[model samples]
Target: MSALPRPAHGPGSRYTARAATTRPRPARDGDVAALARRLTGRDLWLARMLHEHRVLTTHQIARLAYTSARSAQRRLRTLHEHAVLDSFRPLTASGSAPEHYTLGPVGAALLAAHAGLDPTALGWRPTTTGRIAYSPSLGHDLGVNELLTHLAARTHTASGSGLALWLSERSAARRWGDIIRPDAYAHWRDGDPLLPFFLEYDTGSQPPARVEAKLTGYAAFIAATGSRPALLLHTRTASRDQTLRRRLAAAARELDLQVATSSADFTTTDPWGPWWAPLEPTAHRTTLTGLAAHWPHLSPAAGLEPTDADTPLTLPVPPLPPDLGSGS
Candidate 1:
């Protein structure tokens, strides 16, 4: 059997790779070290928290850093000006102020390099747009994961170049009901059946039955929509529950959904963190197209033709949110 292509490890590798590949005068070691040390202890903590969480408002960062909101805001703004971060206007809940702040690709890489044990050996090169940024999760947000799964399903349907389809209530309609509100989503706008991949760094209270129902919903969405988006459910959970696996499979069967499992026994299918986070469009098409195409064959009676790739893998990553206020 052909070896599965490995996922991109993290931003640290990307930076090292870029330095090696670029013809320009390479960034000196002193320069790099200076850049790393330029951050204050508080800044370092704030930066790490933002990169790992992927998105956090100024308020969140202040709370995490145990600093005044003004301090957090200044630190974030400084990071942004230094090209260490980017800001975006996030979609807020009705009647709530919009949350703002997420690490840019470069900022994420710098944080990863600083925090990682062997950043030099990693092959992470930050692309202008196609680059993937990963953050660590706190491992307690089940509700977040549930929403992520739904986002993955949506992404699978939207894999074209430079196009991003988000599923939050502001734009994309809710699938099941109002109760299951998804946060956000994006993918290339190609016609090809995309993979439904979820990335979550947190968890919350979620019942097993709700989880099972979600699996069913995803399966049905894949089957009915005629899109074979591969699903990648990510979390930092310690153990993969057998009950969850069984429920997922039963739901797939009920929905006539053919899922791609790593093992024949329907055990754990994919890794959950930085290891699984680096799949680019080129890598995805080469590594995942065959498996993704299986949906059409498994449910032949359904007569759904697999969607075609609209463009090369490309999508918009929203800007980071702005700082809320000083925590102090």
Candidate 2:
């Protein structure tokens, strides 16, 4: 007997021309049970998270949801078959890379339906979602998401702090694309002051001139937005961080912009430790909670400061449950 046909649109599916370029139709099953059979509340939540964050990896999703890797893999495969999520594997040097996933057209439609909003208004275009998995910057996009996910997980594990809000690159682009588009924007609540900052993740592949030019654009962004979010540069190596600092100084001299540099070379013990050094004169390595003191130009975190019960940088609230995934 012939084997049953596998799902036809995920990482393992055959790439037909129609599948490659078309938008997914909304699932039309009228029976609620049939619909529920297709997806769970947790599945819908995952879809919303993907919509908000733009992209994530299988490992990241497993962490976000309560399931084991095997379960996440099975669920994601089924969802992809129904076009609820689209995924792709980036070009890697050695073994296969973890599959990266983005919101698919059908998932977006479902979310839009629940909210009583048009999918377009919700930033869900069939063509757009269908095409995102194939983007050349998929790896960079995934890396940025990983950064936020890590912070969210870290906040739970740490003593007294957590993420207040996170804006994905697309959200940043919507507001600041005219001047500069940050990789990510986050509101970090520590003890004394709430901190709002723009994240720039550099792989050390872009030319120094190109990276430095962002400072000029950022100067314009600050003037345009009337918001002074500290610029944090995370580079691949210590040398790259040093070179980037020099470039930032030159750019600062030409245009008024403040930035912080950090090398992503730390061991796991303190992966998010005080590796950040402001571009200002007499800058020193400082933790994320300490950046506010170094970069005075940053605006007072708008209405997100922790209460008297919780001290900044110290744990006030109990750690989050492992399954809910930080809920940031």
Best by TM-score: 2
Tens-digit lDDT track of model 1 for 1-328: 1112224563222212221122233233345456676665555544543443344545544443433656666666666655455544322245543234545444555655764534332232333212221222211222332333333333223444222332332222223232222233333222564433322221324555775566565555555556444443333342333334444665655665443322112212212211231122122212233433433343221211223421111111122222322232
Clashes of each: 45, 5
Where does the lowest 10-residue lDDT sum fall in candidate 2? 311-320
| Best lDDT among the predictions, by candidate number | 2
Candidate lDDT scores, in order, read 0.37, 0.65
lDDT for model 1, please.
0.37
Cα displacement (angstroms), candidate 2, residue 21, comes to: 13
